[model samples]
Structure formats: C-alpha cells, structure tokens
Target: MTAHRFRSLLGGLALACAAALPAAAQNFPDRPIRLIVPFGPGGGTDLIARIVAERAGAALGQQMVVENRPGGGATVGIVALVQSRPDGYTLAVCPPICATAQSLYNPPPFNAERDLAPVTSPAELPLVLVVPRSLNVTDARGLLAAARVRQGGLSFASPGAGSSGHLAAEVFHRASGTQMVHVPYRSGAAALTDIVAGRVDFYFDTVASALAQIRAGEVVALGVTGTARVPQLPDVPTMGEAGVQGFDFPSPRLRVVAPAGTPAAILARLNAAFTTALADPALQARIQDAGGKAAGGTAEETRAELNEEAGRFGRLIREIGITAE
Candidate 1:
C-alpha cells in the first residue's frame, strides 16, 4: 500500500478503538472484580473491604473479590494495584499506608499520586490515645505534664516507625510541646501488649484495636485523635478538646483506587458502585460497628484528601527521622 494509504488506515483503526472504549466501560465488570486489601485478613481494612465488596458487587452486578496481599508496609498490594491494567477490573482498598509509604521507604516502590487513581473513600478510622492502667495520668493534660516531668523518659509504643500511630504521637508531641521516646514494634498488637504490660508508656492506637482493652480496663483512654469525639467513645475528648490545640492527627482512611490512566467512565462507574454501597444505611452501621465512619465522596474529594494527608504525614515522618526496616 502507498505510505499515505497506510497512515490513513492507522488513523481509522485508532478512531475505531477510541469509539469502543466507552462501550467497554459501559459493560465493565463482565466478570468478578479483584479488590486488593494491602493488609492481612481480619484487620480493620480487610474487614471493611470485605463489607464493601459484598455490597458493591451486588450493586455492580458482579462479585468484588477480596484478595489479601499483605506485605512491605501495605505496599505489596498497592504495587500490584499500580501495575495492574487500568481497565477497572483491579482495584484496592488504599489505607493510610498509601500516604506514608513514600516517606517510610527510602525509595518508594510505587508513587501513589502518580501511579494510582482515587475512586472514593469508604470509611475513616479515629485513633484513640491510651495509656497503661498503671499510669497515673487521667487526661491529655496530665499526660503532657507527666511527659514534661519525665524529660524524655516517657516512651510511646507504635506498630512501626512510620505507622499512623507513630505519626499521631509525633503530632501530639509537637502540639503539646513535650517529648517522648518512641518504641517501635513489629505489629500494633505487640505494641499494645507492651503498653498493657506497662513496658511502654502510651499508644495512639485505633479505636477498634484498643476498644476491648479500654473496656476491659487494660488501658486507660486519655484522648482521641479526631476533630470530634467518636460515637463509640463519646466521653473520650478529642486531642484538641483535651488541650492539645491544632492536634488533629491523620486518621486511617479507607479509600478505593484504581491504576492511573483508567478511563474516566470506568472510574465513575466504580465510584458510583462503591459510593452507593457506602451510602447504604446497613453498610454505614456495619462500618460504625467496625470502628469506622462511612465516608463516601467524589473522586476529586478523595484525591484532594489523599494529597493533603500525604503532605502532612511526609512532613511529620521527615521531622521525626523515621526510616522503615
């Protein structure tokens, strides 16, 4: 064929494929969708993912399969998500790890902002500041006073150096004008164990993880890290309300995301399905039961929130000089 003819043929094919893109998106999820949970099964993220998957799948007329790909500080699943084809078949329940992974890793394996597209946030978890029952501190003010007197002798336990709990404690320290030694552990459960044993001074743990302990009198709830009091712990004062001004730490948000470059139509469909699931009164109640608030918003809102959180945690992680193991 002549060169001009060949070029014209290529252009025709390109136009045909572009026309088919929306048609394909309209019939998205002809099969089961893979939903990656970056954390191990049974954790709050996984539980929430399962709940949303069940509801969203029904709404989408497909099954949303929950696949646990836990590792690398929740990066393993995210990397898988980023590498997946941007056809909306593969999505992930992006946790706070998405915001902290870049700062935690010396060189991040995946750039969350560049590699992933936010769909919608399904829920937000509030962190509670708890101390061992043996501690004499009654409120956040007393805790700050004790820290001041201890003069770096006081220590706080966290799941790891760059975990949400760790960063929350750092934010609290900056707000309270106090210092505390950081005690890192392999897992939140391990950190909580030490806190209950009085080996660690305090912990800013998720309300889900620490609620049982607090109810059982194993740990004393000093304050919560949220703008307002959590319903489950209504009596617990917020970090700001407890006297730590400008002390709203980042919460563990449950967001859905797809690979970057995914068609806008596909993304919109996915967001609508998930948001509809999130809006279900039963789903909201289930999320509340699981120690999170059902939060569904536009993809743009989710993206903006993620960007803000990434910046906030990045600064705190750098200031604290925390490096992942």
Candidate 2:
C-alpha cells in the first residue's frame, strides 16, 4: 500500500478504538459480575452489599452476584478481588475493615494503596461505643475514668484485627490513656453478643450491627465515633464532642473498589452507575428502612477519605502500642 494509505488506515484505527470506548464500557457485565462481600450473610455489611449490588447491577443491565467470603478480618475477599483480572468483572463491596486490616496486619500481600483502586465509599456506618446497660460508665469521660480505674482490667472485642472494633478501641486507649485486653472474633455480631452478655466489658461496633442490642437496652450507646453526634442517634455525642480529641474512629464504611488498571472508560461508567444507583430515592429509602445509611460519591472523594483515615488509624495504633495479630 502507498505510504499515504497506510497512514490513513492507522488514523482510522485510532479513531475506532477511541469511539468504541463508551460502547466497550457499556458492553461490560456480559456475564454476571461478582460483588464480593467480605462478611457473613445477615450482618450489616451483607445487608448493604446486597442492596447496592442489586441496585447497581440493575443500572448496569447485568446481574451483580454477591458472594460472602467471611474470613481473615475480611482480607480474604478483598485480596481475592485485587488479585483477579481487572476486566471489571470482579469487584469488592467492602467496608473500612479492608483498610484497617491492611494497616494493622503484620504483613499484607495486597497493598490497598496500590492494588485496589477506589470506586466509591457509599456511606459511613459510624461505630458506637456500647456497654451493657449495667456497666457504670455512661459517657466518654466516664469510660476513660473507668479504664483508668480498672487498670488494664477491662476487655474489648472486634470482629477481628483491623476492623473498626479493633481500631476504635485502639483510639480510645489513646484518649483514655490506658490499654484494654484485645479480643478477636470472626464477626462484629459475635463480639456484640459477648458485650451484651457482660462477658466483655465494652465494644465499639457499627451502629447497624449493634442496633438490635442497643434498642433492647442490652447495650448503651456512650458516644459515636465521628466528629459530631449522629443525626440518627441525637442523644449520643461523637467521641470528639464527648471530649476525646484523639478518639475519632468511624465505623466500617461500605466501599466499592475495583482492581487496579481497569480501563478509564470502564471505571467512569461503573462510577456513574454506582452514583446513580445509590442516589435513587427508592434505593436510599430501602437502605434506611433496613437501618443503614446510603453514601455515594466520586471515586476521588472516596480515595481522599480512605487516605485520611488510614493515616489517622496508623498514628493512633502506634501511639497505643497495638500490633496486628
């Protein structure tokens, strides 16, 4: 072929590739996409994961299959998704647990900062400090004094290491200036159970996970782990508002992260689909009705929040002298 003809063909090929990007993105979900939930069914993580997966799947014209892989403090599911091909077929629907585990664990194969690209963090489910109704401590100040008086006598639990429970307790130690025995469990629901039974002195758990017990008065909400009082629980102040300047640990947030290196077009499409799906009034209502919050935003927004929290969690853990189990 003539040189001019060859150049024309190359230009046409580039144009074709560029033009096909949107359609290529739309062509995704040719098969069922796996929305891996790193927790057992019936927990808050499962509830939100299924809700978002179903709604987000509908928006994409593909079935979002939720697979529950509850182990290794939720690292099992997150690592699996990270290692999978980044064709946008495998996605992780997890919470802050993944980030916490990544930081607290002794050695993590998957680098959250590098391997898992943020898609979005739909909403934050702030963890609440709950004690048995019978516990003497009723607020952050009281809890701190109680910890001091107990003299390393109290015990606390998290679903596992690197979970909100573990990290929140770590922060409390800094504010209160004491350490509590750390108990590890496979699930937050399990830890909440022992707290209600008085087998454990206290637990910092997601509001959704501790809702039932808190309502039944089996546990009392001392304060939330945010900067302000949760609107839903107006009676409870945030850890900072409650006078613990260094004790702000939000609950396990539901985050959507795709494997790194997915096409930018595909990532944009997926991000749009997620934001649109979560913003729907009906979907938001459904989440609230189920006792959860729906948070949706741009990929960059989620990344910023995660980055901030990782630094905060890292510093708090080091100050408290807690190590990954």
Candidate 3:
C-alpha cells in the first residue's frame, strides 16, 4: 500500500480503538456485582447495604449480590474485597470499622486508604447511649454521676473491640473522665440481651438496632453520640447537651468501596448509580426508617472523608491505647 494509504489506515485503527475503550467502560457491570457486608445480616449496616444495593443495582441495570462476612472486627469482608480483582465486580459496604481497621489491628491485613477505592457513602447512623430502665439514670449527667460513684465502674457492652461502639465508648471515657469496664460480645444482639437483663450497665448502640428495645422500654436512651439529635428519638439529647463537653465522635457510616486500582471510569459509574439511588425519595425514606440518613456525594468526597476519619481515629486509638480483643 502507498504511504498515504497506510497512514490513513493507521488513523482509522486509532479511532476505532478510542471508540472501543469508552464502549468497554460503559459496558461495565455486565454481570452481577458482588457486594460484601463486613458485618452479620440483619444489622443496620446490612440493612442499608441491601436497600442501597437493590436500588443502585436497578439503576445500573444489574443485580448486586450481598454476602455477609462477620468477623475480625468487621474486617473480614473488607479483606475479601481488597483481595478481589480490581475490576469493579467486587465491592463492600463497610462501616466505621473500615477506616478504624488501620489503627485497630496490628500489621493490618489491609490498608483501607491504600487498598480500597471509595465509591459513595450510602447512609450514616449515630450511636445512642442506652441503659436498662432499672439503672435509674434519666440522662447522661445522671449516668456519669452514677458511673463515677459505682464500684468496679459501670460496665459497657460493645459488639467487639475496635468496633465503632468501642471507639465511641473510649471517646466518651476521655470526654467524661469516667472509666467503664469494656465487655465485648460476639454480636450486638448478644450484647443487648445482657443490657436488657441489666447485666451490662450501658451500651452505645446504633439507633436502628436499639430503637425497638428503647420503644419497648427495655432500654432507656440517655443521649445520642452524633452532633444532632436523630429524628427517631427527638426527645433524646446529644452527648454534648447531656453535659459531656468536647465529645467529638464520628457517627458510623456505610461506605461503598471497591478494591483499589479499579479504573476511575468504573468508580465514577458506581458512584453515579449510588448517587442516583440515594437521591430517590423512596430510598431516602427507607433509609430514614432504618434509623439513618442517606448520604450521597462525589467519589472524591468519599475518599477525602475516609482519609480524614482514618487519621483522626488512628490518633485517637493510639492516644487511648485501645486494643482488639
């Protein structure tokens, strides 16, 4: 072929390749996506994951399969996600434990900031400080006073060491200057069982998980850990309002993340689907019913927030000397 003809052929091939690249990216998630929930089923995180997955999957024109992997302080599923192929097929809806994993575990199995690509945070739930009605503590101040005077200190229940509840308890200890014995349980249900029986003195549990018990009068809610009071418990006061000043606790959020090294195009696509899903009024209402607020933002926002949380939690964990049990 003539040189001119050859050059024309090369240009045609380049255009075809360029066209194919975008087509491939757009065709992403042609198959069902695997969504891992790092906690057990029926929990707030799992509920949020399932709801978000269903809606986002509908938007993506693909189904998302949610798998529960509950262990290792909610890091087992995260490790599985990080080890998966970074092809955007595998993702995980992780809790605060995702960011805290770095500080909570020694020689961490996976670096969240380094190994996971943030998609979008679907929902956020604040911790509620609940005690059995028999405790006779109507508010945080009362609870603190009671804790200070009680012998052996008041005991607090957490799902597990290094969990969000555990971290919140530690922060509360520092802010309130009251030492509480830590009693870690295999699951929140198990812990609540003891709390209801008045076996455990207190627990900082998710509003979703504790709402039923609170409504049933099995537990009395003293204060919410978040800056604002939750709608489900408008009568409840925030920790700060309850006289616990300087209590800076980050509410537990459900973040959608994929294995690091996933293509930016794929990440953007996933974010768009979730953002769309989170914006739906029906979906938002469902999230609210579950005791959480729908959170939707750009992928960059998610990454930045995760990084900040990692740094903050790492510093706090080190300062508090928290260790996994």
Candidate 4:
C-alpha cells in the first residue's frame, strides 16, 4: 500500500477501536471477576476484600472470586496482576505494600505507578502501637523510657518486611529517637500472638487485626498511628495526642486496582460498583466493626492518594535502607 493509504488505514482502525470501547464496557464483566488478595486468608486485607467483594460482585451482577497469592513481601501476587491482561477481568486488593514494593526492592520488580491503575480505595485502617501487658507501658512515653533503659532495647514485630506496620514503626523510631529490634513474622496474627505471649515486646498492627486482643486486654494499647483515634478504641489516644510529636501516619488503605492500560470506561464501571458497595450502611458497619472506615471516591482521587503515599513511603524506605529480603 502507498504511505498515505497505509496512514489512512491506521487512523480508521484507531477510530473503530475507540468507538467499540464503550460498547465493550457497557457489556463489561459478563463473566466472573477475579480479585487477587495479596495476603493469606483472615488477615486485615483479606477480611476487607471478602466484605467488599461480595457486595461489589453483587453490584456488578457477577461473582468476585477472592484468590490468595501471598509471597515476596506481598509483591508476588501484584506482579502476577501486572502481567495479566488488562481487560478488567482481573483485579487486586492493594495495601500499603503496593506503594512500597518498588522502593523496597533493589532494581524493583514492578513499578506501581506504571503497572497498576487505581479503581478506588474501599477502606482505611489505622495501625495501633501496642505492647505486651507484661511490659506495663501505658503510653508512647512509657514505651520510649522502657526502650531506653532496657539492656538490648525493645523488639517490634510486623506482619512482614516492607509492610505498613514495619514502616510505621521505623518512622516512629526515628520520631521518638528510640531503638527497637525488628522481628518479621509470616502474618500479623502470628506477630500479635507473640506479643500476647510476651515473646515480642511491641508491634504496630492494624486495628482490624489487633482489635480483639486489645479489647480482651491481652495487649495494652499505646497510641494509634493516625491523626484521629479509632471509634472501636474510643479511649485510646493518637500518636500525637499520646506525646509522639507530630507523628501522624496515613492509615493503611485497602484499594482496588487493575493492570495498567485497562480501558477507562471499564475502570469507571468498576469504581461505580465498588463505590456502591462501600456506600451500603451494612458494609460500612462491617468495616467499622473490623476497625476500618469505609472509603469511596472517584478514581482520580484514589490515584492521587496512592501516588502521594508512594512518594512518602519511598522517601522513608530510601532513608532507612529497607529491603524486601
């Protein structure tokens, strides 16, 4: 074909594809949608995923199957997600780890900004700084004092390396000028169990994972990592309120994301379905009961939030020299 003729043909194909997008989106999700949970079952991310998946699936008139693919600092599943077809059929539940992975790894695995597209963050759960009851540290100051006086310093546990809890504790350590040994566990539940048994000195765990233990007095609440206190722990103080100066960490958010280059129309549909699911009073109540607040907004807002978080955590990880290991 002549040059001009070939150029005309390409333009026509582009126009045709553009015209077909809306129709494809209108009939989007005709089959079941796969939602990848980047953690083991029963953890905070998994819990929120199941709660939102059921309602979102119902809204989309399809089943949102939850698939657990936990490993590699929660990046294994996300890498799989990034490599999948960007047809809106597969999605993933993104935690703070999603934003931290690139910065935490050498050479990086997948760039979150380049590989994933945000749909909406369904919920935000703050981390609670807790200590074993055996320690008798009632507040942040007490914990600091204990850490300073202790022979080997205190030990802190996280669900895994590069997790929000791990980074939060690192931030806390720097802000408070205290030293704490890092203990990485397979899951938050395992870390919490060690805390209760006095095997671990302290942990910065999501309120969702630690609420039951906190309520049962198995562990003592020091302060939350957010600017505001959690309703579930009404009497507990925020890190700033508890005397860790200017210590406010964005609560770990649970987000819905698709592989990059997914159709914008399809993303809009997914966002709407999740927004509708999050608006349900029953779902909100369930989220609150699980120690998270329901979050819903436009896809742009979700993207902006994730980007800002990635920047913040990226700077922190670089400064502290954190690695996935």
Runs of candidate 1 exceeding 4 Å displacement: none
Off by over 4 Å in 2: 1-19, 250-252
* RMSD, candidate 1, Å: 1.7
lDDT of 2 at 214: 75
> Model 3, range 43-154, lDDT digits (tens) per residue?
8888878999999999999999999998887878899998899988999987888778788778888888789899998898889999998898889889889988998789
What lDDT tens digits, residue by residue, belong to model 4 across residues 35-92?
9998889887788889999999999999999999998778888988999999999999
Which pairs of residues collide in candidate 1? none
Error of 1 at 32 (Å): 1.1
For the record, the alpha-carbon RMSD of candidate 4 to the native fold, in angstroms, is 1.4
Q: Which candidate gets the maximum TM-score versus the true structure? A: 4
lDDT of 1: 0.87
After TM-score superposition, what is the CA distance of residue 254 in candidate 3 from its true location, in Å?
1.2
Report the Cα lDDT for candidate 3. Answer: 0.88
TM-score of each: 0.94, 0.88, 0.93, 0.96
In the range 1-325, model 2's lDDT, one tens digit per residue, is 9999999999999999889878888787688888888788998778877888888888888888989987776778888898899988888986765555555666765777888878887666777888877776788787777777786567888877666777778778656767678888767878888888888888888777787777777888888876656656778887888888776556557789899887777778788888889889898877765556788888888888878777877776666666555
When superposed on Cα atoms, how far off is each prediction in RMSD? 1.7, 3.1, 3.5, 1.4
What is the overall TM-score of model 2 with all chains considered together? 0.88
For model 3, the stretches where C-alpha displacement exceeds 4 angstroms are 1-20
